[model samples]
Target chain A: MAQRPTKETKQSSAREERPPVVREKAPALAPQRGRPTLILVGADKGGVGKTTIARVLLDYLAANNVLTRAFDTETPRGTLYRFHPDQTSVVDLTSTSDQMKIIDTLATAQVRVSVVDVRAGGLEPALQALQDTGFLDAVAEGEVGFILFHVLGSSIASLDEIAEVAPYVDDADYFLVKNHVNDTTFFEWDPVTHRKYFEKVETAGEITIPKLNELSYEQVEIAGAPFSTFVANRTAEGGPADHSFVLRGYVRTWQNRIADEFDRIRLLDRIAGREGA
Target chain B: MSRRTLVFVACSPHPRSGVSTTARLLTDFYLSRLADVEGFDTDPHAPRYHELFPDRTQVIDIAAIRGQISLFDRLLVDDGVPKIVDVWQRSYDRFFKTVKEIGFVEEAHLRGVEPIVLFHVDPSETALASAQSLSASWRDLPMVVVQNEGAAPLGAYAHETLGHYPSTRRFVIGPLDGAVAKTLEQPDVSLSRLLVAPPPEMSIVIRAALKAWIAPIFTQFHSFELRRRLEGAQFLK
Candidate 1:
């Protein structure tokens, strides 16, 4: 410039030249309808019974007559899909197209509640993806509801995962789950350390899944049916099943106990968009 | 019309509180009528009820899950066969807890099975309290208090105390002559067998006394069954 530009002018020009932080736009709002809820169930470690928690959530939602659809992000084959094939789809949460399939249809889907079962060691990435996709923005703006069930294993490292996932869930309903379906003992953690990690997310709550009888659990797995279906003594095809009444009784008792835990947490109220209502 | 199956649960929390005696009476009563009946003896250590009716009864350890399935699942079959269970003193708490948890009573009703808890009332305050507690908690279940005068007789005060229970139904068993009571306790002596075919060595006097002692009790059972059938008919109507 013929007249040497002032420092303030140069700074202003540089600021104006910076590119904008681009974000995918939130999906269009449904016409004057109830806000859709998305529940993400995941764990940092494998074999932590996170999938079992997802299955129980589906059963619980169905029991409460909540119209719910589920996405199992376990690649091409999802365990939740096997039990509840009618209402579930297998998807890859990392893929942009798959994420669109879930996010874009939120307002248009007939079912208002969606459960996403994140694969093991995928919670951080999944949460990061939600942050990047403007889905979390939709949650912040009250256009959608978000819930995170951070299923924890019995180890100190599980606590670390909680801190990592805590940032993305500040505006969401967060729960830490201790699943004892397969394991018997909950490893003792130093109270101070435990409190430190737990307090990282002040609003997070704890849920315990009681241990079910081994034989009963095995029978349910073998039947390849939902817990409620097995308890009803029905096959995967909705036909009469010759399941052992003992195993069915055990499953019913276990399922009822899990339902009690859900009730204690007011899960129905939270998921139905009726909290404090 | 199909008859509703009856499952009589003879239970007492105290040992020697006439639980086995009540179960035996019910089993013998059904057997004498030629009704299809099954008995479950929940006494893991001493299965006296099973021993008394080996062909018709099975011993089950109700503390275990498998035993619970065997007892409760079979009871729910509703095959029109009357069922009797002699719940041992040690297994009493576990038994009722499981029943409540499984909602066995309501399911039994839906399946055309009526479970009647024949609670043995002794002279002890513990017995009275247990009965009162059960009456308060299990209002849906039909409970009958059985007072066996031979084993655990209640004095006037104890009887008056038991009268305060919410249960309106009460059954009295025996204040039998010493000899009749002793003879009935013999392991080989089955009341149903005695009624059907008395042993040759048994004297006519004792047999007649036994018949006199059992006639009114059997009549009581018959009346109860008639009333239940009428109730079922009314329900269907």
Candidate 2:
């Protein structure tokens, strides 16, 4: 019993003296270097992985050195604090009046990148209200807008629902991503259905997200007293995620997919000679 | 919104009860006194005083304060003979060093500004119950005992403590109908009809009371400032 008490004290002291482990800071992205603007991530459908996709894109962008700010319209359900203090994430907690001020701040942007994250089935009404209030016209002046539609494989009906609200953002890039696909049995992306969905949208961005068979996860644990600093201890002393089995597979699959989308958009940018077009 | 000069001290966000109501009504009444005023809701982003009578109004958030305090100062100076509605109460203990009471008044004088301070004191059982859990600093600040029609005897135990501050201002608040009966019936429910307008009798008493109460503290404040500036100076040992 006496020995146990001494061991406990020793452990406690060691824990107290241990230096804090700092997360690797990614460099700021060239695309969002000078101009800090608000990004709203929105989708018009429910259970469409809007929040999850936003989190993944934010993490990937931050890891690759993209400076971004996020906003959530709802309460206690924010996405900025998902990964501990990284350079790529910013969030604005503002009311309706203040949101306008934030938009005004973005107006002078030399390079402003904003994403609107909307709840599934919440896009139609929200867009109409914003348009009625003259907020969207103000926003469209200096923003590269994208409407994300996450659908299950072979769900043309779901895609059809999204298409009904597609006219509002006819000029914006509309991306149809197939999300959380763990099984390929019942749902397959038919060329016929793909063409139909394309016909519905004025212009379709690239189809990017892969099936669940392509997705990967790592067994990472959060340390620190608050259990908030969830470090992926899969990398070298301070390097990119390692070439080890799970980490490499996860990065290669997800990161490469996002990079491919970026490349596709980059090609389009070069062809049009327009950064935001 | 057209920006207007907001002459007020800064304080934390509203607590659950009296603080919000007091701040809101005080601002509303002050704005109502002016012509062509528009009022914004209680917003965390709003500046000290939005242009209630203005061409436009915008809530000034803390970020705005950090970004452009100069703009705010300019507005203050431009609104000549501006009425400063101060809401920051005596948070004496929160400071790294203890604040002498007269230090505050002298700072205002040096700054060439005098804010119309609103010291909110509610007589309801609900308000008293809140005080029981209040911080020591909050309990120590000067308090005014207010009674509306049919209101509870809030001043019964408070008068002895408040009587010490001759500068303390009290009011017999009433509903819009000039009846305290509504306030008495709903002790827990906040009474928005209670305005911050000073009672005529209290107005007559304030100046003399303030002079007597603050006289001794003025010297203490001066001494404190002197000691602060001379801390590093070499003196006769």
Candidate 3:
């Protein structure tokens, strides 16, 4: 399906009046020519900011002009859908019809990216479902761009879940995110313990989501807007906002840092393949 | 809706340029007017301002994430509470680097909180060069060259170098009496408080000397803050 950009009752945007948004990426970058890409953002444990990371990835891809669609596996009334309702569909990942809906559309959809906000405790089952469906095999043949964002908490089990999930993403882009956006600690694992499991994921490059100011993060949650829109001091519909300048500053800084991690990992190239980037 | 909240990052790239002393003075300046002020002493090794005003000040380590959140988060609040962060020469680059990278000045401006970098000028070539580098990087933000006359005579920094700043406002923090300076170095000493209730043991002569020493510097700072007020602030006053 050709997904149109969300056109909520548009208002005069603060971004339109201000100078152009600063681009740290290649300023004149073109759309990716890569194969249809599927990015799974998931964690075995809950509250690791997996969905939060997924939202940031979608925002980053949107900023780069990637035609991106999303599947919120939160079943009904997905939080992802709440923030990005127009581009997202809440689907049960285990259902056959839903699996086909996500997998079959990869090649046919106008969008280049398919981001799945895999629900809490649904990562392994989702991966196994894909494996059983022979989707990873197709991914290996270069028919699609497959990437896994394994958002890990600061627990040993979170690290152990890495080994369990590594087998499924062997042919895909694997990333272990040490999310500390709201957490006080990112990794409770000692250096040796971290390195042991870190060595297991063959192509995994570490991506860190830095801590955001508690107030700014909460404001975004309250506004129900994407981080980019929040930084622009606008609602999701692009209307001007009454957000505190200081809080917006904090969010802008936090957003740039998350983007920096994506840049460091060359996430665009990985999702688009070398030629597409 | 702001009352012109200002966050002054009083610092020097090189040590021994009397940054801590001046930062303490700004804190005292605000405190003297009974204005709400918080002092952040960034030198983890030794926090002089934190020692002097334990209740009003906090010691911060910008290297840690929590420290950054606590310091920067509070710095932006426009409660008519002026904030002063004293940069250790060691944490100087990291502190300002984070500020610039995070667009702290731009964000602060939007919230009606102006960030002023008070670069302490000394009688060294490094001080002059540091001033030049900062003037270039912080051109959009207001900056002031603070000449510590007690450390060295004024005009050590080249006049041409100083002229390059977009809004260069120089202030002197010295010509203070040597004896009074030694007394103010006490951990419990606060010049603002000293002007208030005179200590029982202190003679009237000594109190008068203290007032005389700080009068000119305080007046200079008062005008400096007055200049930074937004339009209509003067009319309201």
Candidate 4:
């Protein structure tokens, strides 16, 4: 029989093999002089559940009594806007006027948090546009609070998107979200490769969205209501609806799991300015 | 005020723990009262409860979406009919998990229904731990610990441990002789029918034994009903 290396030994050996990376400190939760927080949710790949994450974030914020507004960059037919129509506006992020509608009114708007659901294949371009508009500069200068939830697909290519987004988020709260809503066997990246990419952004955190029952997810999609509303057995009009109790239960469980993950990361304390309180 | 609709969930994590027997007894207890009662047999493969009460019980597979909808959706309907579910060991975890996730207890209360768990006590340590876990998880929900001596007689240690759980009440099913137990196992056996009108073919000695076994259990159930109604009245006052 052979003796297995202890966790400490393995960690020390790995540290000796790899270079020590410079880690960034956490940002002040209460933004510089109460600047509103902006969260950009995006993935280079399509069908990675960007809107779903945005919707869950909106729900979490709403449950915590944080006033939030969302912008769906999918243009004329935004999926996020359909589910959260009251506070979401469908816009083309490529257009300057819509960008102004989101960025220019950040401090003036009644909403304390702004969530932007960037379209597929739009992450790099979105970051570039933000850099061109000097929003990244403002974040770097501590003039505003920024959080980028880089939703990742289960592909090596998705890891490549992290490096591209890292330089822009040096001062932002970057999170790599592994969404398992559609597929359970996700993120088959080699540990070394995964660590190498993660090391690109030292302040980056990982959040997992657990798999939800397909039927329940589809039912919520068909109902066109928020997750909380579906769990409450209410229709889009706020009246009692006849949704299946089993499906509603599954959704409620899934939402609670996501909420737990958010709470674990101190998401409300991080972005809602709750730390000061 | 009218009596609140009741939903009795007979459950155990291990097979041969007298879960089905408890469910059967509850179903018959309601039937003896002439109240409208429905039973859900979660074991679609071996639906003994449904077979016994085919007209009143529905066979449901709790693992499947369609079956879950059929069971839970129907349970939410407040038409004043009581429901009893025989949670097969294979479906027990899913059944309780779904109930907690859906917030069924609270919603059932709001709809004028009370959900009570009839946790059958087996001699196994697993059974004792599971009952304690359930009691801790749903502290507000009413639970009744059922000690079925004929199925799985509890040892002193197991008995003492289960006694500590915060159960609303304890119902003990006394052991029956082998002949009577075998006779009750028949698919067509109806306790209510036996108490109301014993068949002529049944031996007088066997009839006497069956009556002695069932009458006290029914009396306990009746007393529980009276106590519940009294509590409701006091709440109103």
Q: What is the TM-score of each candidate against the true structure?
A: 0.87, 0.37, 0.65, 0.87
How good is the docking of model 3, by CAPRI class? Answer: acceptable
Candidate 1 C-alpha lDDT tens digits along A180-267: 8777344544667666666545554788899886777888999999999998999999999988776787788888998998898888
Model 3, residue A143: distance off in Å is 1.7
**Model 1 regions lying over 4 Å from their true place:** A1-32, A183-190, A244-250, A275-277, B176-182, B203-209, B233-237
lDDT (tens digit, per residue) of candidate 2 on B1-237: 222222332222222223323333344444434432223222334332342322233343212222122223222243433332322222312210112211333333435433322334444444443333332334333333333322233356656643533334444333232233232233332112222343334333443333332333333324432443364245622
Runs of candidate 2 with Cα error greater than 4 angstroms are A1-40, A84-95, A108-111, A139-157, A184-194, A212-215, A218-245, A267-277, B1-237
Using DockQ as the yardstick, the better of models 2 and 3 is 3
What are the per-model DockQ values? 0.32, 0.00, 0.24, 0.54
Cα lDDT computed for each candidate against the true fold: 0.84, 0.38, 0.78, 0.82
Regions of candidate 3 where Cα sits further than 4 Å from its true position = A1-34, A182-192, B1-98, B108-115, B121-142, B150-169, B178-237
lDDT of each residue in A181-217, candidate 4, tens digit only: 7784344546676666665455547899998877888
For residues A1-277, write the lDDT of model 3, one tens digit per residue: 2121121211122213433322232221123355888999999899899889989988898898987999999987799988888899999998999998998777777887899999999999999788667677777666777889999887777777876676567678888888887664544446777667676456547788998867678889999998888888799888998776556767777778899999998888887688633
Point out where model 4 deviates above 4 Å.
A1-33, A185-190, A272-277, B155-165, B235-237
TM-score for chain B of all predictions: 0.93, 0.37, 0.88, 0.94
Residues A60-100, model 2: lDDT tens digits = 55555555555444444444343333322233333456355
The stretch of ten residues in a row with the least summed lDDT in candidate 2 chain B is: B92-101
Better of 2 and 3 by lDDT: 3
Better of 1 and 2 by TM-score: 1
Model 1 residue B200 distance off true place after TM-score fit, in angstroms: 1.8
